[model samples]
Target: MIVITTPTGQIGQQVLERIVDSGKSVRVIARDPSRLPQRVRDRVEVFQGSHDDMDVVSKAFAGAESVLWLVPPNPQSGNSTEYYLNFTRPACQAIQSLGVKRVVGVSSLGRGFGRNAGILTAAFEMDALIESTGVSYRSLRMPYFMENMFHDLESIKSHGTFYMPTAGDQVLPLCATRDIASTAAALLLDESWSGQDSVPVVSPDSLTPNEMAHVLSEVLERPIRFQQVSIAEYKATLSRFGSEAWVKDYMDMVIAQNEGIYDDDLQKVQPSDTSFRTWCEEVFKPAVLAP
Candidate 1:
């Protein structure tokens, strides 16, 4: 059996779609099973609860050969690191006690940067805990997600601009959630590889925020500009909607990005298939045009 977590999320939903028809027994743990598509509900066994719940994961992991683990984001989280590990620790115990064969987890880049990168550091710690369980594991260490740009949809639609804490000319790798899902599904299906490893999932295009704006302009047929905001301003904006710890941690993450946390991995790999221009034309443009 293959157990999937966060099956209703962006990347997890795509992973479920790709593997549901592969003749593998699929089970999912969800807080609200009703959100699952009708087709998916009909096919997979549903365990209705958060994956962090020990009872929930212990039962869900039972008789499963492989599992796809993804920790859902919580902006109101108190301590970002503890928040991530809280969700992970239970699953780690279940992975060991249940005798699961393999685990494919969603993680981030900058694992060894030795800097406090907030959520990125949390992800690195999660990787370490999972590795300690000794289950054959693959952590998809992804870069900046192109889908993250959707958060700026209203700003882009109104002013033809996007904002970030980093410089407009700073180059960073971008990956689509689709690529991450595809990579996870491929790994889940193949049983040949084993042991703990990080699969750096990144796209070929290394573009600056300014270059991204240019691609968005061409794709949307409008001139869009990139604006570099102060980290304090970014923190202030986030603080209004998130916990104090969350705001501080995420601000630290943005600071790390500005300081080149993604640079090392960006220089090493570009395994993902999507590019900025292609994503702008195919994904971003359509969203911009949507009602």
Candidate 2:
């Protein structure tokens, strides 16, 4: 049996879709059964509760062979590192006790350079905790999501521009969440790989935010450009909705990216076929054009 955590989430749901289609026995742990899409509820056995709860994970892993593990974002979280570990520690305990054979976990790129990297730092630490369990594990380390571009839909429609703290000329790696899910699904379903290994899911192209603007412009047939925002401005924007603790987490994350935390692993293993332009045309356009 294969188990999935965060079953209704962006990456997790995609993994669920891929695995459920394979006709495998699947189970999921969720906080709210109602939040789950109706189709998903029909297919998998549901273990309702937070994955952070040891009881929840223990029950979910019962008789399970593999699990697609992920920590969903907590915008209200005060500390990024603690937030990730809170869910991970229990999972490590459960895996060790349950004798589950394999796990595919979603994590980020950057090992040495990611220290003090805020939210990403937490993700890396979670990887270590799970690896320590001696379970067969694959850490699907990823870069920026191509879907992050969707945050610009409104501005692109109104002013023909997208914004970020990165220098317009600084090219960064990008990946589609769908590709991450595909990697996880393959690993979770096969059960062939053993031991602990980190798999980098990086993009083939080094597309700068400005180049991404051009791609969006070309695909949407509109004038668009990248607006470089100040890191201070980035903080101020996030501060409106998040506590100071939460704001600091994102602030450090941006600084780490600017300092090239994941650059080394950005182009290794399984360069994604999904391009910025393709994602723009397919995913971004539909959402921006939606009423």
Candidate 3:
């Protein structure tokens, strides 16, 4: 049996679908089983609880040979590092106790870069803690998600502008969650690999916000402009929706990305065939036009 955490999320849902299609016995951890799509819930066993709960996680791991682990984002935690560590500590212990042989963890691109990536520090810590479990693990070190662009969509549609802290000329690595999910599913199904390893899953082509805007404009048939915001302004904007600590970390990440601190070597893996333009035309465009 293969078990998955956070199965209701975008990547989690996709991975679950792929696993179901593969005809494997599957289990998922969810806080609310009713929230899962009925069709998916029908095909898999559901263990309802948070990842932070050791007893629940332990019970769910019974009879499972492999696991897909994901650390759900918690921007509101009083102590983010402690929260992640606390959640992973028990899960790791449970995985070790259950004798699960393989694990696929969802991690970010800046995981090993220390504090240079700000809020992503917790993710780095989580990766370290999970690796310490000594399971044959693959950490999917993912690039910035193309879905993040959705955060600016409403503003862009209303004001015709997309704002960012990075220079419009600078290109940064970006990947779709679907591609990441697909890769994770493939790893979960293949149990031949051993030892701890990190895989950088990134799009072959990196595009600037300006280039992305151009692509969106071509698809939407409306002019969309890219606007660079100062770090101060960016922080101020984020502060309205998040705590000062969280906003500071977020702004620091933008600064890091702008300075090319989180840039990764793309030669290790071939990019997916999905382009930003294709994503906009096929995914974003339809969503925007949806009634």
Best by lDDT: 1
lDDT of 1 by residue, 41-115 (tens): 999999999999999999999999899999999998989899999999999999999999999999998887897
Give the per-residue lDDT of model 3 (tens digit) for 1-291: 899999988899899988886888999999989989899989999998987798898998888888898878765654556667888887899988999889998877765454556656666788889888898989888767889888887887788787888788888788888888888999989978989988877876689888988988999899998999888887777778876666666666677667665564454666776778888888888877766
Best by TM-score: 1
By lDDT: ranked, best first: 1, 2, 3
lDDT of 2 by residue, 115-212 (tens): 69998899999999999899999998887888787777788889998889999998788898988988888899896789889988876777888888
Q: Which of the two, 1 or 3, has more TM-score?
A: 1
Name the candidate, 2 or 3, with the larger TM-score value.
2
Worst 10 residues of 3 by lDDT: 260-269
Candidate 3: TM-score? 0.94
Candidate 1: how many backbone clashes? 0
The 0-to-1 C-alpha lDDT of every candidate, in the order given, reads 0.91, 0.87, 0.81
**By lDDT, is 1 or 2 better?**
1
**Cα lDDT of model 3 overall?**
0.81
